[model samples]
Target: MTRQALVPTTHERGITTLTLDSPANRNALSVSLVEELGRALERYGKDPSVRAVVLTHTGNTFCAGADLKAPAGPYAFVALLRQIAELPKPVLGRVDGHARAGGLGLLGVCDMAFATLSSDFAFSEVRIGVAPALISLPLLPRLDPRAASRYFLTGEVFAGTRAQEIGLLTEAAPDVDVALAPVLEALRRASPQGLAEAKRLLTAGMRDAFDRDAEDLVQRSAALFASAEAREGVTAHLERRDPAWLQ
Candidate 1:
């Protein structure tokens, strides 16, 4: 049997682009998809010809976060976030679509991110009886504390402009590609060593924190996902009903 492919890669002019190709579920982070994304990053990240990597999705939505129905989930997803954060080559995000829950977690790891103003985001985990525990690695550092508190508890969907204002995004464009191109081109012209060293300098403290706290966060996340509250909330969501916790 053929393994279904999730990350398909292309390389040209010192840039490698990995497209998250699963559209059926809005490119959700299934186990295999996370694994494939890790493998793809390792593959291109080590190539001498590659100076940078671009992560983009092929669907209307970038990612829906974890596949709640998967018996085991969002564990390997944490490792994937670490991989993206540590890639010696710069990783730029091309988000032309909405990113939700853990999806925003992955976006937070991008060294630079460009999203379309049309795209919306939410920390929907709270609404479903869990918290964005593991994702807070890359997330909390980039976000304004007041903004983070408001959004984390409310789970409200915010526009790209608001996201940028709160430090979740570097820039928002009317057209995603238009915002992404010049950045990629500028990265392509940069000295590989310069980019690598700068990225390392820029993210050292962040990565140190991720390494220090990731295991604990992952444990917290798994516990939450396995809880009665999460199970009820997720089931209610799938069934299109209000969860019991809601008034």
Candidate 2:
């Protein structure tokens, strides 16, 4: 297979690993990266040899969120998140470190998520004067609305334990390899046809909800991007200072 900045590697055991390789920026999701990811996922979902897919990242952070330095313009990241959520095959998020904002959106899209004990998770878009748009559709159904409201409003960092408690993660392990083993094992034990059918059954009820939420998210996110607070917050972060809006 051809390689790109985002590395897509498949193991003989039918576990495809897609690593977000932009370590310098903590694997921040760029538009090109998301597009490549969408393509890779589409290919894997169609390949009969590929039984399951694992999404991960390199370095100390899983993903820091969208690459704020690169202008997303509009709906770019949101579309990518929807692609992940709608992928036909089983997708597992193997989170080793921190997953914030759009990064957390990736976790939500996964059919299952396994985070390391040391991993941190947060819906931190609020800190940047935006909402967690892409992930909220998946998250709202999994999490209590009250819990979602609290985290989305505060943008506070929470540990893996809290992530599991809030229904954001399947389980927390001591390390990445350990976290991935159970998911791989489960995939191995299930017939591919059965897995697909099961996934469809589970997701059928949420289809309408996801659709409505996606529409709402796009509208609100676009409005937030145009707000003065988003501009100030993003500028302050890029400049390595506190946001004046916070003060």
Candidate 3:
């Protein structure tokens, strides 16, 4: 059987849309998906006609987190996040479904994000015995400390409005496309050089955080994922039973 394209591309006017097409696993970040997404971003990043890149997905779950069965390496995921942050053109996110665990990292990396009010989000790494280490590179600088603390530690789900209130989303309305229309128009109207400079100023701190802490966090993430506790947690999750610690 032929392999299907995991990340598909579409362009309209000056905007490029990259859809996460692996709905079979709720669009989890697998190695192939990450690679394809990086390539797409690189291609659009260099295209002057592509004023902005929109990252969206094709399922009820925008991204269910790391693909447990075939998760991408920590370094690769970090690189993908960095690419979004460093892209010359603005990267926008349109989320109309659920985002959990590492998936939330995508929203944080976007220059701006819009979601439907009914969409939900969560930072679920804790339940699986790992910290949200790599994702914090983009999220920590943007998220409200108090809100981050609550969700990060508790692993609770929050609606798009709460996500927006905590800085994870730019806007959450009844319709994501409606919310994004004006922003897309503004992006199309803005000068390319102007947008690049503005994005540089906006994302400098995040890029610095990546440089300062990404390696250490990657090591930390690898260590955690390899631990006995994490193994048990993951196994239990897959088995649909409570982890040992909860007993």
Q: Which candidate ranks first by lDDT, i.e. highest?
A: 3
TM-score-based ranking: 3, 1, 2
What is the Cα-based lDDT of residue 96 in candidate 2?
82
Candidate 1 accuracy as lDDT:
0.87
| Candidate 3 residue-wise lDDT, 1-247, digit = tens | 9888888899998999999999989999999999999999999999989899999999898888899999999999999999999999999989999999888999899999899999999999999899899999999989999999999999999999999999999999998998899899989998899999999999999999999999999999999999999999899889999999994
lDDT of each: 0.87, 0.80, 0.94
The segments of candidate 3 whose C-alpha lies over 4 angstroms from its true place after superposition are none
Candidate 1, residues 1-247: lDDT per residue as tens digits?
A: 9866789888878989899998987888887788789999988878878899988899888888887765226568877888888888999888887899988998898998889998899999998999999889998999999999999999999999999999999999899888878888898899878988898998897899887998888889888888999999999988999999888
Q: Model 2: which ten-residue window has the lowest total lDDT?
A: 3-12
For lDDT, candidate 1 versus 3, the one ahead is 3
Q: What is the per-residue lDDT of model 2 for residues 182-233, given as tens digits with 9 covering 90 to 100?
A: 6698797788898788888777645666666767777888899779999998
Best by TM-score: 3
In model 3, which residue pairs have backbone atoms overlapping below 3 Å? none
Q: Select the stronger candidate by lDDT from 2 and 3.
A: 3
Each candidate structure's TM-score, on Cα atoms with residue i matched to residue i, is 0.96, 0.92, 0.98
